[model samples]
Target: MRFISRTSSDGVTEQLFILGEIPGVLWTPEDAAGARPLILMGHGGGQHKKAPGIVARARRFVTEGGFAVVAVDAPNHGDRPKTEEFAEVVARLRAGMAAGEDVAPHLATMHTFLAGHAVPEWQAVLTAVQELDVVGAGPVGYFGMSMGCGLGVPFVAAEPRVRAAVLGLLGVDGLAEAAARVTVPVRFLLQWDDDKVPRAQGLALFDALGSADKTLHANPGDHGEIPEFETGSSLRFFARHLG
Candidate 1:
């Protein structure tokens, strides 16, 4: 891993780095040391590693939970060059959406393609991040929603280092098998009236999880309207399982 820059503010430190072909950011408490629990955050579709939500949550996790948080741009996202095949898939999705068609299938296809690359990318990032002195090998947790959840289900299932996860805002279409493979503690958030992801599909995804210790937190809102209090609940959930 090669660090590109480092900045500090408000008791938190942010470091940007390049690992192989991936560009990512890591956040931790300023002057942090020793092994601390690490949280890997995944941003929604079309969003980059340092999206407003990802940065806010990463800083909060670093300052409040005393944990190291990391985020990376998915393939064909942010600083990465887009592939022709990926562009074709996205065009189909956009056309489907504009036609007011059932875009779930298109979304599933996209997630499947992305997960093929993202899962291994996340595993490699985790391996590299844990090698750092300030963020040693330790219990890890994942926090992702929407497209993040779609991609995360496979990563959490395939990676043994992840001890817990906060996932939701996605459906069970192309992810049920992976969801069934995840046995770690999970806190799945569902938006009661999500326009992008149907309520029933979201509930189905939660039900498909194989974890014996999993909780579903549902609230009345759209896809982007998750209640703010859920963030506090997520911190507590990670504390319970990852600490």
Candidate 2:
């Protein structure tokens, strides 16, 4: 159920897999011949890896930010088929959010699903980046958006290799909870008018962080249209800290 394609440019060939098992385009660079910092990408609820915003963001990471980007598809999303495991989690989270009950439990389930799936997908990616380390690219980073706030936060906190973090459209509890645990430098790009998650959530996340160096960048757009390259400042944050 997976379709894969290889695209090359300037001696760098990236294997783009339309993963049937997970339902997202897993892009892993080939012949990198060295270790490189990795960026694991995530999408919002009910959305796919092919969303224009997410795809464009990945492109920006590669072309401009000069990092390896693994754009992931969560369960029941994108080209991947839906399953009871996924549906149950989604429903539980939705219900929890609606009832104003604690959603931390459902978030745990979603994180487990993502981390488990990252094994095979991350394999192709690490292959390319590992060799590049001879020259320099150090530990990896997690840059996620929307639900990515949930998935990325847990993954980085559990994995000590994560040296930099970026999040967009983060929920209040998830962001605040993860921010407290993140020992690395973190940046949050928040939309002041985001109807889905609200701006206060991002502000709360920035404020909750125990890290000495954390940033919260607010813009005029809502959840939908973030200024392209909104991550320019984020990359700088990583450079100052992760470099």
Candidate 3:
């Protein structure tokens, strides 16, 4: 890993780190040292690691929640170069929809392709971050939604270091199998009127979680309209579980 930039504010320091092709930011509290609890944040589709929401949450996790935070660009998102296959998938899906054809098959194909890479990419980021030694062997947690949740389900299931997770804004179809393997404490968020994801599907995903300690926070809104209060609730959840 190599340093790209460093900035500090309000007793917290945020640094950009690049690991070969993967680029991400790390947030550490002032005077922090060895083995602090870490939170791995995942961004939504079309959002980057440094997106405002991600940065804000990272800052909160480091400064207020007293944890180190890291977020990497998912495949085809953020600063990473887009794959031709992903672009083609999007074009095909759009063309199919415009032609009044059912796009469920296309959607499934795309989800499978993305999920295949997303899980391993997250594992790579986690491995890289752990090697940095800034965050010790403390408990690890995850926070993600939408495409993040789509990928996070499998990642949390496969990564034993993640002790808890906050996932939501997703459907259940492609992720249920992974969700069934996630035994970590989870706090799931659901937008009641989500247009991109059906409420029933979101509930099904929540129900599929193997976590004995999981809580659902359902609110009235569309996919992008998650209330600030829900974010606060998630912060508390992480603090309770990971802190």
Which candidate number has the best TM-score? Answer: 1
C-alpha lDDT (0 to 100) for residue 128 of candidate 2: 43
Candidate 3's C-alpha runs over 4 A off are 96-108
**Which tens-of-lDDT digit does each residue in 44-135 have in candidate 2?**
76777767766666665565555666665665667677778878777888998899875555665665675566544544443444444422
Cα-based lDDT for every prediction: 0.94, 0.64, 0.85
Model 2: runs farther than 4 Å from truth? 1-3, 9-12, 18-33, 89-137
Ten contiguous residues minimizing lDDT sum, candidate 1: 56-65
Model 3, 103-127: lDDT tens per residue? 4456556767887887887777777
Model 1 per-residue lDDT at 233: 85
Cα RMSD to native, each candidate? Answer: 0.6, 4.6, 1.8
Per-prediction backbone clash count: 0, 11, 1
Per-residue lDDT for 78 in model 3?
82
lDDT of 1 by residue, 92-123 (tens): 99999999998888999999999999999999
Measured by lDDT, the strongest candidate is 1
